[model samples]
Target chain A: MDPLEVEFLAEKETVKIIPNFSLDKIYLIGGDLGPFNPGLPVDVPVWLALNLKQRQKCRIVPPEWMEVEKLEEIPFSMGLTKLLLTHASDNIPKADEIRTLVKDIWDTRIAKLRLSADSFIREQEAHAKLDNLTLMEINTIRTFLLDSLNCMYKLRSNLQQGSSKGQFSNY
Target chain B: MSDALSDCGSDASHDGGQEDVMTPAELIEKLEEAWLNEKFSPELLSNRSEVVECVMEQLTHMEANLQRVKKGDAKASIHRMEIDRIRFVLSSYLRSRLQKIERFFPHVLEKEKSRGEGEPSLLSPEEFAFAKEYHANTETYLKAVALKRMPPNLQTVELLKAVPEPCLDSFVFLRVKEPQENILVEPETDDQREYVVDLEEGSQHLMRYRTISPLVSSGAVQLI
Candidate 1:
């Protein structure tokens, strides 16, 4: 069965959540989606059971505590991609193209982070330079990084999968 | 007064049923369920708030009756009296809550309407500040009040569009800033509209309104 589409309706905003296909119904209910309630904000700590349809499986990942990486050191490539895709700004004249380019840069950045430990260290040092900024502004910067990086990674992954078509490989 | 009450009990159900043993919270829960099922009658609200008092007293009476039964009073008449007492209490409370239930929807609707049309908001800036204050206060409050059940920022605001200049001369509104998210509106002589908006971004059903100002009436109850 296809994944059950879960829509979050809050105020006038609508957000559709897509969980990984392997997540189970029980896990979905017990995890973030089930624990999501209207009376409380998203950050509340509550144990709740979810009741997702049987088409998908779910798993619960505990909060990961890291000593080496402070909030500042964590990469923003994923969030940046989402923002570039969704957020529109009048100030950034070439926002779309710049976002695309930023995303490509991040893809290379992530590959460096994932494949070589030194790349991750270098990125952390770069982000640390923006320490004087407020948390919100820092988050925006990180989000920008995530958006570009993720897009590039996905493009690369797609190209690799489609490489079987010999004539189209160069393109 | 006690003798006058005993006669009312004699005329009601004579068996101690399952409802006789339920607590006040449980009874309200049952009434809530009844309201959902559309099984409630118009007579539900006829008794007013007395219904809640009566139900609470009835539950107390039944508990007393159970004690009597345990002490070796198994007489059929005694058991019947217990049942009758509970039934009357349940019916009375159910009716009262149900009666107010209708009033609740209208009151909320009226408040929303009045909020839309009523006075220019002098409270906008204060309200915004209060939201932030509430967030900070809630952070402290939640440490003591159990964060799992209570949110760190629970602010309710009554928002109205800026009033036009023509209406300002005749209207008077007072806005009092309180600690955290609480704002107190002074006793308003003219018509007043208050709306409670829940600012939690993740929640769907976050806004509600009521005409009877808790400050003017019985005071508002905060749920954490």
Candidate 2:
């Protein structure tokens, strides 16, 4: 239901993925899943895509030609993400709750970052401190913080509404 | 279209100019007329050259003012006219033309507004773009983690995006959980029996607190 489109690399078309959390499946927006590794190298990509759809009813479409350059080089966090997905499966309520909680928590963190940025900008305006930072730098920090918080807020709303297909947690 | 040109020419006469010294405004009108007529004329080229000079001078003036401001000397306030002029020159000409067209077609602007308002989360363009990007990157991060068999690390993640919300300084405290006292009282026994009551103690207080930041604005002001 959420209008966001998830783009990922796939073998044929650049698949637009949508997640169907209620059904525990991901419908390839324009296509479907292809052959991939079974181990940690490809689990998160598959599980994350599938679980996100199941929990949010959205899909994650791979971009074109998204091959694993090196199987051994995969990051550990992706595997951890898959583990969380596995643990939370079948308990849709818990999974959805955690997804919401993760996003809400991330939103709070972003708000804090924004507050820090605002303080920094105010100090710059008041004391005119550009000791180590350019005015643009300070402005950039402020912009980034605000942008992050706003983004998290959108995701939070989307998750709460159960229409966040193709949309990911802002965290 | 013929009538439109005559009207434009009459309007152009309001401004003071030499026989060929048309202002940028007149040049714009003439260019529009020419485009409508689908005729290429040598005069259009000359007119465009003059407009370019006016635009160049405007930008030079702004650059000088910015230099002064950057050096802590804010003597001159860059006026809006000069700013518009500079912008016209710097950005592609099509942008200005599109703006003019949009002005003529007011419904386009209204449609854009309606689309945004229709969304459940009324996020600004910048906010939506950043959020989408963050989601993508987060997925990328997850994929990276899975590939490497490494533990999830939040430190590498960059939370902020290029455009921040405007009202980011406001914050509110949220009570996540509240304490409640329970009293269990025993009621009457059956038929011909008497009634009795029992009471039990409950928690004095129990609650959890969370700081809620409003989604309406940035709500991220800091004191630095």
Candidate 3:
């Protein structure tokens, strides 16, 4: 299988189209497509829609997520993974602008998350000092702190190693 | 060969082809620029093959020049490494294009069939042939697997039933570009042909992805 196929399968997005011509039911290796009518809106795979658009047989409707206002309305709690999986489309004409917006949102949300997590852990630690913390609660916080610390350490070491390599490569 | 000599000698002539005679560093810079530009722009798809061909030609010339330099020279090794890096990028770039061709093989085949005989494929001939063979093999394998699993009584059933349908049930947001009436099948109301919603020129709404696809191709609203 081609790498792009794998990528598409992993991250599929549907495309909207308005056919300019009518057609009977067409069968494809993957599946069957519509008994299309001219001027009626139909949704199809992005690849198929692109092919039809290229042939001048259909008009493509831009996805709603492409709108800047809608994108801004996406809540921080949606998480980056969900946002990336659903919103990212190669066909988007303003992808760079969207990507920058996404990055900014992700950075802001992550900072907020980190702040909350830190305070929650600190509050738990304080409660534990007074013997108010449960064993399960202690374990959860312990795991979170360990994971975060390990990640930070790894990132720091990688940065240091990269700089050292750059300095020595000149020689 | 004489061709290779002429390819190299043309660089020294003061025609407008300064690129042909560029130094190793300059050549590497040019290659890097081309690669980055290709990476960033979707419009470069048609021109990619020629860009790659030019890079390969320059790389060949670079390798020939390196052969005359001392093996122990640091500059020679560095240039060789740069060539290797460029070569890797070129291969990956080609592979990405091939992937797109393969993914859209059915559409490509349909277009090709409609075109005149002896017309060129978007992909290189070798890649197109490979895609065709791969598709054929997959179909055969799927049929064989389906036959093996069928019950004796249903053995005569067509294999088409066993073929999985491409999943097309994802919802997407769409911005309405043109004002048009649509027959909406909302649960609250019966299928209504009356303009359910007046699609203002720049209004945005979350709708079934297929509903607005045609507008996108017609340069209605651009995907963000």
Candidate 4:
């Protein structure tokens, strides 16, 4: 998947936003969103929140995890942090600190991922645990990693005689 | 849009196995799952016409309602935005399928032809038609450009052998939705031995697509 598409998925995650105007409960296909009252916080998807912010109709309340200290426990995605920082940094407090902290977290996570990937390649493991790795992190190394795995598999398969062709399970 | 949609899809389902109603939200979830699975899987998955039809119905219904509302209503705009998001997903999902069909048309057609009398199809009706057309055009183009230049004995080309089949040994990242036991993990090389690992519910894993292809169609696991 493209990194942008991953960002698109992040936009669906709900965040608290304070609308500047009042509105009735809007029953949407996915779910209801509004009943927005002036100066009162309501939960909304980031896409809608960003749209409202662009119109100067609302103030985005960054998710709890966007804070510098709270970055460690974020349930949301790194792509989301970037999206919020890029689009609605004004609403988020200590934006620069959060940005730096987010970078730190991402760097640490990627570093750990590289370590694991190196070991995985060295050991020639069949499968690896995907615990706590964000989708984007996995995506970053997916192509290179899978290609290497396949190349190794092909080399091994050639060593064996009459290994059957891979079969796709029928639906 | 992110998850199960519980409020819509009261229409008759052609899938026939489950009489139980799938809510609109759940239908949406199903579509997204199918989308991602199709996107990541090396092979074309079975057609999900039920989800496609239901989602189309829901979109049509919501759109019909929007037509009655005034243009400037805040609710209408929000509804439009939601619809656009869903529409994007739906189209992306379909386009991915089309791309796969184009890539593996001969094998896909062969699979369809070789299936049993009552088995589920790999392609939807429209997709099947498109594949047939694509196959004819490709053959015509090949014959015109190169095949016709060959000796009569060598002119005949087998597309099934020519086109590379999807490699099921390719790895994928998946999340287990339903817990499963004794799922076999095949060895990658001669030195490593095959082993079975119990798939715990909600746990993610990186593994070969072939090992969990059945689990995917059964909705027991979702391809990330």
Candidate 5:
């Protein structure tokens, strides 16, 4: 993984911290940490926060997304769509609600991606008709279309299967 | 009802002999758990191929089972959807693995080359060949464009701009867990090696990665 991507993931994961003692600002190669003050809550990356919590230097506040109420409202919160799809937490209080919310979010994202992919593919096809589609453009569109179509098929199947399982279990 | 009960019975029985067979749902659940737990460490490189192959085999079985169900059956449709989901996850996992390998391709290749023996690569044969070709092309281009113009005395290239530098030499913020004494080796002097730094527990510092890599791996320190 790229260090940038690692940093991005860490940045996205917020953790609340309460420092135990006062400390001078510690400079790191990446950046400075803090002139940490005791008894004050501060938000930091999960990695840094977790380390502090482990050392008994700070108390950690979990991310808001992990809250059950927030998770339950996820399906309705179309504007709140910055959730990382890959960060699956096993110990969430409401597993079913979270699962459904994640599925809904995945479906929404995939739908948007498919829409863009379809237009791009169509444009590429039209360009190809005029022999104006460059090799790079063709390859890019091909991969995008393939991935979008694959995701679409998967989502469709999941939706169908979920409904069918409900009906089957009722019988 | 009997068929559903029979399927449940088979699933229950399979718990005792898990190596024999697994239901599609169980397989999917397993794959999802595995995907969730995957940390993309270097040690997991070999295991990833095996896991992918196992998932692919189960998917093939699931596909066959799906086909056997009557057309328009809801259960069958669900199975079809599950298969697609599994495929998507598998593909994404493979792609991420590929990206990691590609990012570290030059470093991996050099390590393998220095061993003086051909070893298995995390990438497929085609990808490996492509990386080799790409590196070769980049080196030739760099030589032609920049290196060739430089005076012969100053043309000594320390490292290729195209290849990624080793991350082990980079400084990182590390939190120490266990106290230990470490000898600090100054790069400039071979004679002045009396400097000893004491690593204190619960303290964090930005230090050379090589100085802390062993401690990190041994759980004596953690990278922040």
Candidate 6:
């Protein structure tokens, strides 16, 4: 999957936003969004929140996990951080600190991922428990890892057979 | 949109009406599941025409309602944005299926041909037509371009051998939705030992697609 597409899915994660203008409840296909009353907070998806924030119509209340001190304990999504920091940084307190902390966390997690993947390959393990790994992390290694695995399968299957033709299709 | 759901939603589920009474949110979720499954699976999966038609009906109804209201309304804008997002997913899901069909048309048609009479079809009627047309066009193109010049014995092409099948042995990341016991995990090579593992609900794993393909079809697990 494209990283942008992962970001698109991340945009669906709901966040709290305070709308400056009052409006009646709006029915949406996914679900109902807002009966926006001035100075009152309501839950809205990140996509709409960013749109409203960009238009100066709302202030986004950052999710609790985005804070610097609490960052280590909570599992953070890389796509969500990019979306929030790029568009709604002014509304979020300590945006720079959050960015640095999230990056550090990302680096540590990725280092662990690499080490595990190395062992997974070196050991020739056929199955792995992938709990707690986010879609973004899986996606980063997806193509290369899948291709190599497929190649290994093909190579192993070929050991018993004579010749295989036109196995890998053209991109 | 909610009011008009039962008015037309049931009509779309003519495949025995299994998903007859889904809410708009549930319908979107089903579509997303279908989308992700189609996106991750190595081969073409069973078509979710029921979900597709319902979403299409819902989008049309919502857009028709939008047309009646004046522009520049905040609610209207929000509704438009929501519609656009759903539409993006809907189109991307459909486009991925089409891409797979193009990549594996002959095998797709072969599967359709062999399907039992009362069983649910692998391809939707429109997709079936597309695969047939694609198969015929490719044969004609091959003959016209290169096959015609070859020796008569070598002219006939076996499409199954010509194109690669979807590699089911490829690894996939999935989250188990239902608990399964003693599912066999095949060895990578002859030297490695095979083992069985329990798939606990809500736990994620990486394994060969072939072992879990049935689970995927049954919606027992979701490919991430």
Interface RMSD of each: 30.1, 28.9, 27.5, 5.0, 28.5, 2.4
User: Model 5 over residues A1-171: C-alpha lDDT tens digits?
Assistant: 233333433332455667787766643212235667888776654556544555566765445665556755543322112222223233235556666765665565556545655674443221111122222222234334444433443354466566311100000
The worst-scoring run of ten residues by lDDT in candidate 6 chain A lies at A162-171
Considering chain A alone, report the TM-score of candidate 5 relative to the true chain A: 0.42
Query: After aligning candidate 6 to the native by TM-score, how far in Å is the CA of A99 from where it should be?
Result: 0.3
The segments of candidate 3 whose C-alpha lies over 4 angstroms from its true place after superposition are A1-171, B1-47, B116-120, B147-224
In terms of DockQ, the best-performing candidate is: 6
Q: What are the per-candidate TM-scores when only chain A is compared?
A: 0.23, 0.28, 0.43, 0.89, 0.42, 0.92
TM-score of each: 0.18, 0.18, 0.33, 0.92, 0.35, 0.95
Best by lDDT: 6
Q: Which window of ten consecutive residues has the lowest lDDT sum in model 2 chain B?
A: B37-46
Kept native contacts, as fractions per model, are: 0.00, 0.00, 0.00, 0.45, 0.00, 0.68
What are the per-residue Cα lDDT tens digits for candidate 2 across A2-34?
Answer: 111011111112223443322222222111233
lDDT of 6 at A92: 82
Question: List-wise, what DockQ does each model earn?
Answer: 0.01, 0.01, 0.02, 0.45, 0.02, 0.63
lDDT of 3 at B111: 52
Pairs in clash, predicted candidate 5: A157-B81, A161-B78
Task: Summarize candidate 5's per-residue lDDT along B28-63 as a digit string, tens digits.
Answer: 444443343233222223223434555666667557
Model 3, position B214, has a per-residue lDDT of 47
What's the fnat for candidate 6, on a 0 to 1 scale?
0.68
Candidate 6 segments whose C-alpha is farther than 4 A from its true place: A163-171, B7-20
Model 1: DockQ score: 0.01
* Model 4 misplaced regions, further than 4 Å: A73-76, A162-171, B1-19
lDDT of 6 by residue, A20-85 (tens): 999988778888867999999999999999999999999999888888888878787788888999
